[model samples]
Target: MSGCNKKKFPAAKDVVLLHQLDRGIFTPSISPFPLKLETYMRMAGISYENDFKNPMGPKGKTPWMTFNGNDYCDSQLCLELLASKFQKDFSSDLTAEERAIARSFQIMTEEHLYWVLVLWRWVYTKGKTLWDVQMNLPTGLRLVMPLAVRRIKAQASAQGLGRHSKDDVIEMGRKDLRAISDYLGTKPYFTGDKPTEMDCAMFGCLAQLVWSMQGSPYEEQMKGEFANLKEFCERMKEKFWPDWDQCLSPPRLNVS
Candidate 1:
């Protein structure tokens, strides 16, 4: 019997990311997963094109990537695939224990923190108002915004985080932020001076919470209490986003 050989895939030169628009620093991404993937690419020095339309790729999700000729979905899976293909390990310098710790925090951020963000944006009134303003939907499409909110609420409910009272959910999110802040005390990055996959994961979550969810109770709490986390986000933004000021400028409108 002949053994099946692994197919050698070509190195990806042109990579395209479909994600939400840049609405100033307030909301770098409407969804965190795509932001995570984008941050990862930047950290790895991989050049990619940004395509905002039709965010749901082949897998019906944002953050999906088109590499070479194939489509890859899910942030974690896409990271693994890109790392393997490019021979770049985001955690290559970490010790075994550090890697394990990073993985744990990454999972916590994605699984737990992400849901809290969803609830904050779609379920709560204050957060929903902020989201609407940042989204800046057209007057015609504004009528459907409530329907969109309802759909998101249903999704949150199915995901189980929405089952809890709003207070409980906020508390859970606060605890998560506290844990991350404590772990990140006085460090330039999550794993020390250098940014790792953990930092990428964390930056994705914290950046949105701190900058995008401004005026919400959660953001207020973070700013008032978690100094380290706020500093961490700022540091990352300065280091990775050299065009930060450009990103904040409003898009030029076309006049007829």
Candidate 2:
């Protein structure tokens, strides 16, 4: 959309859901899967809540990705593998398969990071952050978009989610790189021999997760823990735009 316009800021998760390939039922907490569903419906051009007890999609694309007329982005493992890829070193740690996942994740991360910068630019030059654009979000999805980061903190405290937080999302993302580095048993890619939708999904999810964890505990801990994720994030940054998060425009929203 015109080199990443903020028009989709309100639809970030929707964008993620639509183009996403597949989904798993009842994967894990309200996270990426719901994002995939929203993205899938949006991509297929459905943007409203279904009032019917059972409402089916337009009978094709969405149906294919759904179970009982519901879309799910089956990417839980992909996301986990992504963290592994980040935490592990690629030079001496990755098998051929892991390398494939790393490469695929880097490509996708680059694409999203470029747009993140664009959104930052637009937040100042054109529109408000989606946070300000509208206070409402759509429903009938898998994950919860979280009213705010405070809610995230509260959720963490309530669940005692063990070393994970709204912040560890990024650390988990950084740790994903370890997949490649730690994989002493496989070849390139987590699934072996090829880059699949899993690889691509991991890319976007991990990148955003790390991006979200900007100043969390895991972030400080990860500064040098996995040089691979940092280097890979940088490499992806350079691959798209050499100067990222530079002094272009002030941030409008704290995405975490």
Best by lDDT: 1
lDDT of 1 at 48: 78
TM-score of 1: 0.85
* Candidate 2 lDDT tens digits, 1-256: 0122112212322222223222221111112333333322332334333222122223211211222223432333323333343442223445687567655655544333323322322322232233332222234221443333344345344534322433444434334445433531333433444433343334334333344333333355335554444444343334333333441223335443
* lDDT, model 1, position 133: 29
lDDT of all predictions: 0.71, 0.34
lDDT, candidate 2, at 62: 24
What candidate 2 gets wrong by more than 4 Å, as runs, is: 1-181, 184-194, 233-256
Assess every candidate by TM-score: 0.85, 0.32
Among the numbered candidates, top TM-score falls to 1
lDDT of 2: 0.34
